[model samples]
Target: MLGAVGGGALLYLSFPPRTLWWLVFPAFALLGIVLHGRRARAGFGYGFLFGLGFLLPLLAWTGTFVGSLPWVVLSAFEAMFIGAAGAGIAVVSRMPAAPVWAAAVWIAGEALRGRVPFGGLPWGRVGFGQPDGPLLPLAAIGGEPLLSFAAVLAGLAVGDLVRRLVLRQGPRLLVAPALVAVLAMAAGPLAALVPATPNGGEDRTVTIAAVQGNVPRLGLDFNAQRRAVLDNHVRATEQLAADAAAGRVPRPDLVIWPENSSDIDPLRNPDAAAQIDRAARAVGVPVLVGTVLRNPDGRTTSNSSLVWEGGTGVVERNDKRRVQPFGEYMPWREFFRLFSSYVDRAGYFVPGQGAGAVDMAGVRVGIAICWEVAFDDLVADSVAAGAEVLAVPSNNATFGLSEMTYQQLAMSRIRAVEHDRPVIVATTSGVSATITRDGAVTASTRQFTPDVLVDRTELRHTTTLATRWRSAPEWVLVALGVLAVGAGIVTRRRAVRRAGRDEDG
Candidate 1:
């Protein structure tokens, strides 16, 4: 139990807001040691304890607004996946190259966790924690699943080495574990050698602006001042226009507003439409305005980004495809409202269908609104559809002053490398950033402040191996894990039968 908790703590510390990414190996090593020779039930218990230690603190941000109930429930549920991983690891621990099998098991568990119960919440994924680590480059080769597998394999190898040393294993017995450790550790630097063509000469370059308009106030009720929120973004864009006219900044070809920048749908509200039109005219370019559109039934809303062209009104648009559950829209409204009144506060927003890319003034901009950026497929799909650059329009005011923004920023950086595309992150309440295709932040804004970030961004048309393969690598690793577990079970049963036959003789 102590080892499990310690391991979890180490893994949590390896995440964003900290650069201790190397600590993840030791953390996983400890977890491997705890579950190495344990029974399946004991492994599950230890894994659950490790998960609690990691997730409880890591996900504390979830309860910042709604209280601790949801946070606790979420952590507990996610931990079950880890517990199942522990059971699988234990089953395969006696197999040849056990560390490799264990690593595969971890990836299989993550694959499952990323799919079930409302398309899965993939926030605490191991690969997401490696943005600042040496393994970040691996994301370019095989996406998050492969990167995670590499990290886990390295850790498991370390644990195996430590166990062999503690048991005083002979040199002949040590060769395989040592070789695995060296190879796993070497994979990161080796993968890093792969050239990343983010903004090669063939790709085009465009000047873009991402506006961050400070919200009225922090918390869920910030939307209560709906007009105020809309006006804030307008004012910010107008200021950017003034700066451009005065030669203070380059004229951007397009401007992007974060999600929920205009709470009132401009199509339905003349005043909202006029305000956005004036801002687009002032900027002398199309403004990708994020707004909520009410359906004809008036019972549901669509969180959409519309290209409001100067003097032309709405021209091109892309509705956010990955609508967030429990926040953007409630899943089981009636049943959940019984637990907390806050459930009723959830929006009646419905997910939209599209490729998640929109053309604005000859530039194809990929859009992943707020929660959508967390999903791997959405970003990959946009790139597959020929998006030149990526834009993540987010509204983080609801979470208040928490680590949520920075954590999300890290995800964007990882995605930049994954697809080899420059990323523009426009946020409602600061931390808005323009990231280079190489996963470096060129410019960023301070929190809770109104700011405009104008920069020349390169647009790449080439698709990366990660983008091309998509989830295939993940599925392969998952299959390997299942096969390894099944083989282990068969081997164990055979051994048991042989021992019984020997006893009968």
Candidate 2:
């Protein structure tokens, strides 16, 4: 149990805003040691303990605004997936090449965790922690699933080797584990050698700007000053225009605003519409204005990203496809309301359809509004739909000064590498950044600051293997895990029958 707790702590240390990504291997190695020969029930209990140790702290930021109740509840729910994964690992531990099977089981657990209850909260995915690690290159090859597989395989191999050494096993016994570890670690650098199509190797460059206008204050009430938030963005863009005119900065081809930058529906409200138009005309470029659109029924709303052209009001628009649960809209509203009054505070936002991409000035830009970035399908759909550059328009003010922004920033970085496209992140309160295809942050803003980041971004039309295959890798891994579990069950049953026959003899 102590070892399991240590393993979870180590895993937590691997995540942002920390760079100890190598710690994940050792963490999982400890977990493997604890669960190797344990019964399924015991494995679950130990794994749950490990999960609590890890998730409670890693997700502490979640309670920054909404209080500790939601945070604890969310952590407890997510930890159950890890507990189930531990049980699966135990079931497959007796199989030949157990490390490989165990690793596949972990991926299977992630697959389930990423899509259950409320479309699965994929925030703590191991792959997201590897943006700065050796396994990062795997994201381009097979996206997050493959990256996670590599991490788990390497970790389990390490655990196997360590266990063998401690037991004074022969060198012959160590060969397979050593080879697996070497291969898993090598896969990352080898995958990195795959030539990335940089900006599609074309001379076309689009100078784009991401505006972080910030809000009046932090917390849930940040949106209370809705008009002020909109004005802040307009003021920032206007400043950028002044800078461009004075030859201080290059004029951008397109400008992007953070999500909820205009909580007041610009299309319906003339005041909001005029403000956006003024900013667009001043910048002399189409502004991707993030706004809330109230439905005719007034019972629901759409979080939309609209392109406000200088002469043409609103042109192209991509509504946010993955509306966040609880934050955007409450699930089991009536049932949950009994537990906390915050349930009613949830928005009436609904998920939007389409590929989450929009065309502006002949440039195809992908949109993953804030929470959408956490989902694999959302980003892949945008890239597959012909997105050359990706934009993550987010509003992180509600979380206050927490690691949520940095953690989310890491996701964008991984996505940049996964799709081999430049990623522009525009946030309402801070950490707005421009990430290149290699997952490097080129420019970023301080938290709670009003700033505009202008960069010459290349448009890449080429797609990586991840974008091409999409969820195929994850599904394949999941299938392998199911087969391993089935084999384990069959093997156990065969042993039982053999024992019964021996008793009869």
Candidate 3:
């Protein structure tokens, strides 16, 4: 049950405003000491249980959007990697090399989990817990995976301190404590030394307007009035336009609408295009409209954000890099159809691939849409691809006023500081946000509300060390961790041979 408790604790802490909950990871990781050197099966059980405990709650957001099935299914699948991690620990820790081998096995597990099933969930990683902590700069050198490994190292250190103290290995126990202190404290100052790069563009600050075309109703049935939903966004932008014109709100250099604002294709449908044109003409600047585009090669569609410039018309675009498995499109259509009919499979939607950024009137914006914000590579690549400001145009209308919106908003905040770029998050059913490079929210809208957030935060043309060097640290850590495991394997075989010789004698 330690797993369940730890999992619940993780779920509570993973959300916005109070991301401190991630600190539970290192504490939960200490459970390894109790289950230490157990059989592989036992270790797997504990790890799986811990994974279930953490994943069940951490992924409740999936249930909030899709249903309990996805939440349970995804949690179970993700927990498998944790089980494998436990098995690795069981094998590695049995050797004389405890500290090095154990840490490597754990880091390897996290890396594996992050990349499975269409590159992996990677949501509740211990590294994310350090968002507000100084160790966050460590992400520049190593990425989140490295930060996660470091957190594990600290946990291992604490466990080692206890073991050495119990054994009365005075100096060794002191060594463990010293290790913990160093890892925990070094999160500051040194993390700043890692390489970073900013999203490119003019460094000057410009007022940005984020339009939330709030849905009239909330749920699957909500999109019944597709035209009404489209009109709401148009109307909200119209209001912001009026506000800007009168100086009630600062005149924005650009406007943003959330993904899927046009249930009915805007480019093809003259009426829908006309409505967008009117809003752009009113706003007097480029408006990024998230829409479903028709691909000629089949009836399949692409979840795309098109730039609808007032005088220029449709200009630049970015297709969502990562699509939600079941939500955006279904996997193994025939196999799953037997289980549930209401699969609401985004059967028509097509996945779009890009380096993660698109251009807007010489301004490069990184687009982190919906679930993509939770991903490290997506935002990191956007900044690396020369995006100046991060724009997350998401559609959370289906999930309503749960913590999902808030949690996603928090991710935007971390990305701001992680890459030192301003982030613009436009959502269909609220939590529209504008964040600064220092990880502060300049302005935000309430959930399920039709509102506009007006902000003039400095748009960063600079990069943090994290942006310039992405995942380089993770590769290095992985190599070192693997080497430790390999050495442990060799040492264990030698120890077994020595024991056999002693028995023969």
- When summed lDDT is taken over every stretch of 10 residues in candidate 1, the lowest stretch is 195-204
TM-score of each: 0.97, 0.97, 0.90
- Using TM-score as the measure, what is the rank order of every candidate, best first? 2, 1, 3
lDDT of 3 by residue, 1-505 (tens): 5643474355346445575744543554454464466666787777787778767766676776556886798888888887777666766665554645566677777777777776576666666656666556665556666666666665655665665677788685476555664665576467776445434445677777888988888876667888898999999998898887887988988888899887778768989989998999999988999888788875788888888987666888788878777777887777777767657554556668888787776678788878788788888888778877889999887776666677677667667766777889999988888887666676788888888888885765776666667666666666776776576557667888999999999
**Backbone collisions counted per model:** 0, 0, 12
After TM-score superposition, what is the CA distance of residue 197 in candidate 1 from its true location, in Å?
A: 7.2
Best by lDDT: 2
RMSD of each: 1.6, 1.5, 2.8
Instruction: Name the runs in model 3 displaced over 4 angstroms.
Output: 1-17, 94-104, 166-172, 193-202
Off by over 4 Å in 1: 196-202
Estimate candidate 2's alpha-carbon lDDT, on a 0 to 1 scale. 0.91
Would you list the clashing residue pairs of candidate 2?
none
Superposed by TM-score, candidate 3 places the C-alpha of residue 360 at a distance from the truth, in angstroms, of 2.0
Candidate 2: tens digits of C-alpha lDDT, residues 1-505: 8998899999899998899999999998998989987778888888887888789988898889778999999898899999999888888887889999999999998899889978888988889988899889999999999999999899988998999899999999999999999999999999999865543445478999999999999898999999999999999999999999999999999999999999999888998899999999999999999999998888999999999998689998888887889889999999999888889999999888888999888888999999789999999989878888999999999888988898999999999999999999999998899999899999999999899999999776677888888999999999999899889878878988999999999
The sequence of per-residue lDDT tens digits that candidate 1 reaches over residues 1-505 is 9999999999999988788889889988999899987777888899899889888988888899999999999999999999999888988988999999999999999988887888888888888888888888788889988889988998989999899999999988888988998887788788878875543436677999999988989998989999998999999999999999999999999999999999998999999999999999999998999999998998999999999997899998798887788898899889988888899888888889989999988998999998788889999989877788999999999888888888898899989998889999999996899998778899999989999999999876666788888989888999999999999889888988999999999
lDDT rank order? 2, 1, 3
RMSD of 3: 2.8
